[model samples]
Target chain A: MTSASVDESTRLAMYRDMVRARDFEQRAYDLFLEGVVQGTTHLGLGQEAVAAGFAAAMRPTDMTFCTYRGHNHTLLRGAPMPALMGELAGRKTGICGGKGGSMHLTDVPNHAMGSYAIVGAHLPIAVGAAWAGVLRGTDQVSVCFFGDGATNIGAFHEAVNLAAVWKVPVVFVCENNLYMEYTPIGDVIAVEHPAADRASAYGLESIIVDGNDVEAVHDIAVETIERARRGEGPSLVEAKTYRHKGHSRADPGKYRPDDEVAAWLERDPLTISRRRLEADGVAGDTIDAIEAESMIEVDSATEATRNAPPPDPATLMTEVWADGGSEWRN
Target chain B: MAELTYRAAVARGIAQEMERDPNVVLIGEDVAAAGGVFKTTEGLFERFGPNRVRDTPISEEAIIGAIMGAAMNGLRPIGELMFSDFLATCWDIVANQIAKTRYMTGGQVALPLVIRTANGGGNRFGGQHAQSVENWAMAVPGLKVVAPSTPSDVIGLMAAAVRDPNPVVFFEHKKLFAAKQEVPEGEIVDRLGAATIRNPGSDVTIVALAAMVSVAEEAAVVLAASGVSAEVIDLRTLVPLDTKTLLESVSRTGRLVTVEENPRLCGWGAEITSIVVEEGFWHLDAPIVRVTTPHIPLPAAAELEDLAIPSSEQVVAAVQRME
Candidate 1:
């Protein structure tokens, strides 16, 4: 069951999710350029397959945590396009009511807790969530999605060790996208396969998968996630992939060689899925139709965000504490 | 009423809360099997078992992070930092995650977590282990900072902290662990943002916090010997400061003196100075005097430690200097 084959329709649905994420990123980038969206955005331009495949494998009740580059993950995890886009645009109707912006997107009803901006910080939180499930004796598993950079931090090690010691149900997904914001993983991390090596140190099973391959990611994620749900303890899955865009809103790709960039771009998740669909005797128009629908959805989301009202300044002081409490007496 | 030691009061408060709510739990290094280094969580491990009372690794960041996560998931976790100085090691988690989660989420979540840690000097635990850093939590907008001087107040404040729907940093003084006070038998809870006037007088108003409350009391006794009546107010909770009670007392007394064990500059005492000068300036008959430890790190030696910590003599001198 670890390498189980998924049905063709299900595969197509996952491919469509990748396209949705891609289209949303492109549209949001355009909106950002036009000043419709406020604040910097961390786009997962070339890392859509991991998000799409992981989302496809998880139960809605299973909780997930993400890094700042979380737009794709939140969307695939069932955040409404209007609310997600509204948040990026700082609208009152946003998922977090416009207070959290892009770096802190959350959809608790869908069970994706948040996108913590700090590196490696959410690992312990995810461990705690998984521990809660263990205490309840439930089948719920927590997935913590972080980049290659987070692997070196103290929290990553501390949380993973605790999870393994307790035998809690969690899957630490390390999306090894090669670069940790301009610095190569090789420069910072010494391990050949970080997640695999780190996992063994903590007595956890590790799996290495091609992150750009939607089918592969879905297969491996399903296997690990199911094991966790069955209380088989925590595991680490490293998905090797690359980000086609710059690190964030401002960076340009002067640091990377053009050949390396061209090589990775050719293996883009959307292109790979499209070629697979064509070879499977699926009509080309069917693939084109999926892409067209995704574009329309993203464009409409942008239009709605433009018309959405700005966050009200009058309620700025509200919600600092649950009971509207303050540091001083009124 | 029952007489309990300060540490015993803390344990009873937690045990009672855990008995009432199954969701309430304690997690920290040496808390479970070891019963905590200071024995603040003594016998809790045996009472609740491994599930409720957890012993975590020496990871302050993870300790705080787990507390925040557990609380968000509908459990109330009481995390122990061992020493208040260690708050710097996990400041990111404390300041960013636990303190700001509910606010950043736009009230979609409530933390309902308490971080209990030993603070203040008098033990020869050196600068790192014996300092009081309540100002770190007090400066953060979303945190509630509570410091209790006596066993009764410890029991009451612990009950209040665990029940409040916000993150509260409950600072326990290491010096007062063996100190005994009368505590009511069951469920004694104090209001978080209210001050208790330990002694009332018309000559001067003396506001003290945590360990300094006792210091202020001794100073008031000395002032009484000199025929100068002094009012002493214990500002139990620093964040949701009982500023109104403070202003009212200062208005009546027409003189103000604040005492705290933290450094004299920008400490809890400094905060009171600003509040009094801003609100009760016209009511004040003399300038507000703040009695605090000198602006320096605490020393390990006994003599230097005594000099660095605020004493009853300093509080009295500040009051007499006002006269």
Candidate 2:
């Protein structure tokens, strides 16, 4: 309602990004099962819309901070598929040079700061980046992607208060995926609306959107991000969605009712986007080609990452300090 | 050379850095307007203005977290935690984020930050407020910990800390803030990982850290009168320890005594003792004695507080035991 209807090409692009994120996460999940990936990975399987939608709204100059389940965001931020997967496999050519596994992904050139493993810890850091942008007098907005669990942490309140007071250009996007790890947010948080209900306390504009609807997310993201870029201060956008996969590997998710899971699974973001694309006069063959291309991309990335060389032991002590201070072996 | 108090020297050092680089910012609780509770950052608020010099809310975690983020974003932020003891409240930011950012990012980003804090137990601040907790930072790999005893050392070392490529924790002892010394004029930056011999002697090596350096110096003067020649070495930085200087002194003296305000268990002195034993074992003619606070939290009472910190007499006794 704030702007013109999203074009057909942009709609197709959103669908494609969603498909790409889905394929990458599915392949990464398989890799985890096969023991090819070293540690556990938090997958954003059912929550792809928020990643693609918000990423679509952001400019190349804008910086992004994300949570542990951040591969989708990283890919949309311009990192190559091979590099991200390679990092997951602990290869030398990984995004973090194999130093950081899945939880820590940084693509500075692409403006993806890093994915923090700790919940709510990176919010303040994101505010700092936004403050830097404000100090430098640039239109760059720092977008912080956190989960529902982060809202309960002290850092969430501190960062939001600080950002609101300073009126820094920052967008706090909470991908409220119904649960925090294994625990449902309802059991933990006191509020009925986690992101929207709590916005006014920090003096921020709150928006609640169907996270499963990629187009709606895109529209709302575009508005909120523009508001931030215009120096309107920080805003909280809660993308209501659900995760298909468990919190981590081996979590069969026995806590949720079977009917609830089934119902949410039926409303999968990818399926909705695909259906919307077809209804929007986009050819079925074009959507099929996009899905097939995403599969091919994921396949090649996995193959390259599996074949990539492991990190050299000789280089293990490097990068601890930029000044070459206190090498681990030295 | 102008004589400045240790507190003034630290303030001047930060002021000089701010003048040199516009990107250098000071952010902490009570840093602006109040000029810091310790007054170490006095006059910085007025000189740098509120933008460069900021007074943050009493959120230690956010202060450090923001500083780390600002550093990564090409701003050099020097945040004060008020007391080194509050590091307990914000250890995660330092341990998981600041200490590991560069290494975890594979040198993709350099965090040029400085955490200036007040340390030591001589003040009647008691338990929580009066802990010399440099050992907590020394345990981390990426962090560089420097504690200066004299005004000259603080001014020079503080300048080096701000300009260092990595994150540095500048530990200023609470007792030495008012202590005056002749500081050299102009910009002076003492290199990290370097040790200076306060006094040369052939009998015993007295290695002291932070405020203990002065105690060792005093003990050295006392030892000289008793015909016990004790050499004093001031360890300016704890992380990149000047082991070569320590080993050389221990080799010449054939005796070692370490004095620190921290407890005996797992203290900075323990790290030095282990290093000496591992690398300089052959040079040691006697057991390396450590003059450290007894393993206990400092009590509030005046007498108990005085009893908790290592004294010049304790350093003298440790050196005599080493002999």
Candidate 3:
């Protein structure tokens, strides 16, 4: 029922984040096609609103654990553009110091623990982090972001059960983009609405919102995050979103129908958010300036990362063990 | 030197570590006021308080998962699963997460965690509690598995494992916990992945681990009286196995006898025997003799349990077969 007390500048900031995520992903996809980036990528093309909404509501002190399609999550969690671009370019200045590629990006200082490649593996990990925060009497809430495919995993069930039993302050954000890779969720599970039905099974409150609407998604996230900080236990917020690109770099998404894609494209999150600002009496020049500034920032980061050095061969064995003052391996 | 039981040395090591590091904490069922099912964690709760020595619910998966999370946030957690056989309940956490986290993450993080559990089948705790499951952990890539046989070895290995960066699985023999030995007075640290020669001889080489080490040593004396000198090598750690010492001993003796308290099929003894055969193939005079438990579940009765596990008589017989 509550909405965020957003000002003109705050709305523009949210718009810029969405634009940056969208633009960076598009450019990365182009580079991936040209053989500049080596590995396959799962771009966050149409899911910018989910990241922008949640990241806008959360504090830098709060922790976030994400899945493979997590480039936007890392950027929204305050990972510098240079470091993020360096990781994609496989440079030493990357967030994981060029160790982790696109699938595993981490910036611990920003409280964004790396994304896990395994399906549903990070669920129990996030639950444990939230439990630690609660035991330490810290009001810091941990956010776990996963796709609809992860819901079918056993680790997801075990993690949700533990989180519910302990009443740990965590937000389980499921970015339900209708299709889990190629198989639609409707064909897999018997339940009509995945999050609404499953959340109640674990004794948690559920909220289903229009994920394409940035203002609505942001307001709902802010409320749920506050509830968690007040020790009111965990909540499941299922953002009904869609992806414009294929599952990975190789997939052309021929499995999905053309009319379905067109229908969702008409309700794009970025277009809707800007139109809402215009209707609310916001000036047009301010919005255009924000978009221009974000493009310049993204271009600078891309150039810096390309020029950064590759990781040293000797650095491979550094983080394997702690410096315990004993030369056991040498 | 001071005389201390193997169990006492292990308990002292844990208590000393907890007292030294504020980040070090222990979690297991019956580890608190009950002082662990084997009394290894005795008086720790009184000294360190409940926060440090926590009694977790009977969920092995949760215990390991929680420790992994704590370790990620700069806390050193020691989780105890009462028996090695019960590790099956949390195999996913151990195999998938704990073992592969470092490699899959491209070495971005180090798991500073220890899982201490009792293994080997000498006690009459039946099939559920008595089992030697060290080989399962040995098959895993990233985990470091260590099994110590004596009081002094237990103290040194425990301290080393606590300070190790990678996740270590410390397997303690339930039968050897009450056995007394001369231990060093101060704190001692031993390097892992090294084998110790308990008894030296020139006729034949007998390789053993955990509770079987004592039996191998006893059999060596019996073999000497019969004019068949047998050397005994205690494989202290299983994963980073001491193939160098094992092959060297076999090269000198030209014969081998592998002894273990676990089942014969695919046991840790099989791994050691394979290494000797592959590395020291030309040095072998006869086929490698394996003295191990029958391929069956451990029995509950004292008499049946004694028959199920390998003894000194079996080791002596195996040495004679090599002749």
Candidate 4:
């Protein structure tokens, strides 16, 4: 409905981004099982559409503040697969040189403003970036991504209210995947719609969309991001979706009913996007090639990351300050 | 040279930086129209305007979070967290988010930010409002902790903190707001991690910070009457600590005494004494002494608070006891 519509080429690009995100997450999950990736990782296995759609709608100048489950968003924002995987594996060739690990993937040049692990911490930081645009008279927007659990936190309300009053260019996107860590989000949140329902309190329009639908998510994102750039103020969007896998590594997700899991799996975001691509008269061979290419890229990225060396022991003593060294004394 | 108050230097220092750069902004609760809770930023709102000088809701997390974000982007934000004691509300933003972002990002983020708070006691604002938390910031990595004693040092150190390519928590002592000094005209910028020797002597080395700096100075005068010449050193910054200056003075004087307003355990004095014991062990002619507040919440009553924080008499007693 907006002037900046998604054309045919853009559609193919979004689909390709979705495919790559899926393949990359699958490979990363397998690596986690093999213990090649240490610590923990949160994946967007069934929630790839939100990242692909919103990232596709955003400009390169606009910044992104995503949560810990951020591999899909980072890749969709144009970060190389190898660098992201290398970061997950804690290698010297990682995006942050093995400093950030998986939960804090950041490529500032690419506008991925790091993935924060805390529940509602980055919301205010995103508002600050947007406030910079208003002060500098720039058109750049700041996009913040969080889970359903973040809506209950105090920082979320503070950031949203401040953004509305300041009329800063920030679009807060909440991916409501029905659960926060292990508990069902619905059991905790009072309102039916977590993010969009609270938008009214901050004087923002309540906009909720099917996060599983790439086009639906992209359309709302384009509208809100443009609205922010035009100085109309912030918007809260709730994208209803589900996580195909558990919250973290080793969460089999046995809490959900078997029938519910089957029903949701049938409506996978990748499948929905692929189906729409076919309905749009795209050649079957073309879709097949895109999928194959994504698999090859993920395989290659995994191989390269596995072959990479661990970070230098000296790096532990570096980067504590801007001087590029951790020396506190002369 | 025009005499200036310690509180006025805060506004002047921010004004200098705001005039030099359009990207430098001030955001906090009651910072724009009402100046600030402590009136430290009295003139900044009028001079910088509302866009650059912003007032926020009583949201400490949002204020600090926004500062971190703006710093990472293009803007250099100077956040005023009314009272330093209120840092407990948003410690995650300061300790976890902004502090670790640069190091975790592997030098990718240059968070050029300054958090100026009304720090320390001497007011009847009670324990919740009048805590000296420079030691809290000193314990965290990637944070440059600064607390100035004099009005001129306030302006100079504020400029240095604003210009630094990292995050600096500039603590303006609440007790020293009315303290006056003949500050020179024109721009005055000072370096971080440098200690100034307030009074030069060779008998004993007395180190102190912020409000305690003047207490140590007064104690030096008292010790002088008793024929005990004491050298007083004001530690302007705590993070990139001036261990060189401290070691040089301790090596010459062969005695070290620390005067701190913070509680006994894990104060900045502990760090200083540990360094002296490790590096300046042979230089010591006697045991190093630390004059600090008792480990308890500062009371609102004048009598109780006077007994809690480190005073000039206590510094003199602790030093004479060292002899």
Candidate 5:
């Protein structure tokens, strides 16, 4: 049964965001196949709940820094789908003005720093942002999203240590998709549960959650985010999940076994959330309506991106220097 | 005017800026209690407190990344890399993030940050410690590079760098930290991208930077004795090069000699020469000469280290060769 205190409209809004993320990713995959989108894409096909759940619990003023596999993260952070699709299409109308492709989408107004292509590069940056917020006496909290592989980077250790020592208001969420590219988690990392175990090492609070369960992630994220806002320092939320797609467009995923993909797909967040929604006496027609509307939204964004203009040659010289002096000109 | 060493002047500049702007802070190794490896941050932690003047671990990437993040969030952070050679560890953040953030952000953000570090080969600190990497920073577009040779210039230029709205790389020559001069009292601001004429002469132009400015001045004196009047131009800032002053000096002299402590191959000297030939070709008489260190790692032995870097004699010889 749906919780009595949970407002129906709020639940519907969350469902809408989930559908938006799923539809956006599906459309992105279709466009990739159609050769309309260039460059490699890392799809969040099944892990939509983690981004939707966590982002829903956050305030618009809170900052987020994510990794390259961040399409869902950007979408859930309130970025316009058209801008994201336009960026993926390499058009000037896109976020970052098409300079940064999918892996580097940034919308500062929504408090989303660019998703760094380099693994673990944004860890220290997130920590620094949190430190600035704390020093400035702001209640804002900064969130960092990275994969299990990023835990091995030197920046992760250094950043976490500094955050713990300074008691900076920040949360580090590791989307442990059970694989670092093609290598299984157990093969590369010595620790079984990386984020939970690593957080304690830095003397910070740690929580482990079922990343596929939207309610489960939302509950824990709400607590940790509040603690950070209260200046209780940083916390690590290890969300255990799996990626439905290959690491990038190039990989056919021959490395993973068929049974493994089938097992993860069975517990996909979107399907689970839909089942929960239907079980709560949401009409089948309403579900269909939501799906139809999301499809329309995604389709329009695709068309808009298709017609978007390519960056002008003169635009390349711009944004390099803040003074507008063309240093590239010989 | 107050008499101070180059290191003390730099320390005073940082301390004063930290007091002036709450957003301006200092982060580096041993900057808090120990006053930095070169004492360039002396008494900063005591004066500004640890929150503003913080000590960092030996992680160069973290230091630079923290600075970039803080700067993006509207803070003027002056990060120190201790030795210029250590910059290699954080090259990705410096060359990619800090340098490209403003451009990539579509001018929506400004990285008003400064990275100050000591450089040069006179200390015999071995290959890892001694280096003149100004050329590497000069290659980056968004970064403004400054290397002051005197205490007066150090104080003035550092104040300007802290107030600048763009990222800057302030290269402090370790050998010149103890060199003393009269620093002006109160606040002093020197314009970035402007070269200072150290010695006005008529025969030839000698362009130099960092510790080499003193070498050029000494060489000018030596040249004056031989009836070769050499104009010494200290290129205080490398990236936003003051081509106007350099061209004027070169045009009047008709001969040019660039000197640097870094290796000759692909050094700042080459960039100056190319710019001169491109913009002021008609002013040239003889081929532009460059006096630079040999392309070899600095040895630990004092004698060998002395041989590795350029000296006043070498600069004088290069000027003579031009004649």
Candidate 6:
């Protein structure tokens, strides 16, 4: 159920990515508390396995679109941690020059193509990117990540059906984290499996995985993404996961029953991945070294972000048009 | 030069761009097989085939989203919305996603895309189908707006819109589709935000767009018979608005009157009025006049719609009132 059939290198890399994502998110949350990160930030603390597994499976040419809780996904895709933190801190050295802030971190060169703040906006957008593959004769698949909440939105249905109709290469991953915001997802959605139950509506197979387990998530990602690259159209994979923190800076997450919270925390992605690595006969020294390296990387990123200057006022008026100016009239 | 119907010019414009660049593709409802709801896209599917010219279900969101995504990647795509009024259904994608993606992504992505929609009334499409929505795009930042009145301008501005590195909302007036004009031969490329003086005069400036341009010309003739020399300026684009032409025309005429199919109250005419009053304040002999349809939904009844929309007679009457 864990990293049993996976190779030592693959398992190690998966564990390392998950640890890096966890460490970076933890540091970002701390920065938010210290008032370094202005505005609201949605941290993907307990959902690193989904981001790490999907990133590991995806190729460099492949593109990804995620929600506001997207720091883990962006960093796992090889975006420089300093820039990601810098963007969160509203610094000039940020990936988006601090204009996009935490929710809109984008590194198109690294294939982490834009995080959307609006809910359900990126589902169809990712489908559009995949449509480029179909038109241009490429196998580059586009991956879209969202929560169980997004599955009920109009864009999710439109995007899935259109991707099926056009046979575009895209994978829609729904991280069913049990809660939409303060309410449980099961309370709102009519179906049992939020995404997988609706897959049949678009003529796709229902695939549900243990999102807390890195190997399971990676295996599903590799399969569906490959299916898309092969021109087999789109697939919807629902990963059952949980958010360890509240929805945003404003939420204290008191609505969640204590037992449910304790149960999900017990299956934290980093802990699951590391325990699996140790069970696979990997040395404790090797496992400990990866965690230590991730800590050092996140620490330096935090330091660099704090020291960086805020974006110049000139950046405020730039990038409205591709001509490199916001000016509309001559 | 040859005479080309405004509808035929739509197909010709798309074909010319698609011929020049392999990246240019067309997507929308009935665009591929049925040649668009207005039949403006005839022969495109046949010429470009299914690869370049694709059709979709009535999924407006998907169509818009597909073009935005393609533009982000490599292809220069064009989406033919059946009607401009349908922009309401997918306003989120058009206004939020396509308009803001480049700016939000910090300009890493270039959205060289065009959304061509049939705009304005004449066929009496009721309130839902008939609307001059260039104002809708004009109100939003990060979107380029273009509305060509004549077939010649259509072929020219369509080329410019497709070539632009930003998202452009192209308003093709449905009423002008049947009208014909002499289009010059070979590769007509016109710049956006450039105003063309259709009929130059001195006494009063008549600013018009799309269907209203011809109406303005008709009123200019009636005004000429009455000794009021009215200048007719066709504003081809709205976002990169031809403010210089507007100010220059208003300065020369000492009076500004705008003719538009959009209802009054916050129409593009209001913005032009604000600009004229702000910049050309000293040049005014009287308050700026706006000859527009009363701010109400266009009725389904023929007589009601015709009476509600501004006419050449109304333009003449408004000019007379100004006198």
When only the first chain is scored, the TM-scores of the models are 0.96, 0.96, 0.95, 0.97, 0.96, 0.98
- DockQ for each of the predicted structures, in order? 0.67, 0.63, 0.30, 0.82, 0.53, 0.76
Where does candidate 5 clash, by residue pair? Answer: A319-B103
**Which tens-of-lDDT digit does each residue in A1-330 have in candidate 4?**
331367878788888999999999999999998988878889999999999999999999899999998989888898988999999999998999999999999989999998999889999999998888777777789999999999999889989998898888999999999888889888997888889889889988999999988888899998999999888989999999999998988688889888988988999988987877788788989999999999999999999998999999999999888879887776
RMSD of each: 1.5, 1.6, 4.0, 1.4, 1.9, 1.1
Q: In model 1, where do residues sit more than 4 Å from their true spots?
A: A1-4, A324-327
Q: List clashing residue pairs in candidate 6.
A: none
Per-residue alpha-carbon lDDT of candidate 4 for residues B30-84, written as tens digits (9 for 90 to 100): 9888989878889888887988898998999999999999998889999989999
| Candidate 3 collision pairs | none
Give me the displacement of residue A132 in model 1, in angstroms. Answer: 1.6
lDDT of 1 at A241: 91
What is candidate 5's lDDT per residue for B1-323, written digit by digit as tens? 77899889889888778878999989988999999989989999999898898998788888888888888777899999999998898888888888887676556567899999988878878999998899899888889899999888887888899998889999999999889987678887787888889999999999999889888999999999999999999989987888889999989999999998888789999988998999999989999998888888789899998888889999889888774
Candidate 5: segments with Cα more than 4 A from true spot: A1-8, A328-330
The CAPRI-style docking tier of model 3 reads: acceptable
- lDDT per residue for candidate 2 within B178-236, as digits (tens), equals 89988778987777888899999989998988889989999999999999998999988
lDDT measured at residue B235 in model 5 versus the true structure, 0 to 100: 88
Give the fraction of reference interface contacts each candidate recovers: 0.56, 0.60, 0.21, 0.76, 0.40, 0.66
Go through the candidates in order and give each one's C-alpha lDDT: 0.88, 0.87, 0.82, 0.91, 0.85, 0.90
Q: Which should have the higher TM-score, number 2 or number 4?
A: 4
**Shift of residue B317 alpha carbon in model 2, Å:** 1.4
- The residue-level lDDT of candidate 6 at A317 comes to 83
- Per-candidate TM vs. native? 0.98, 0.97, 0.85, 0.98, 0.96, 0.99
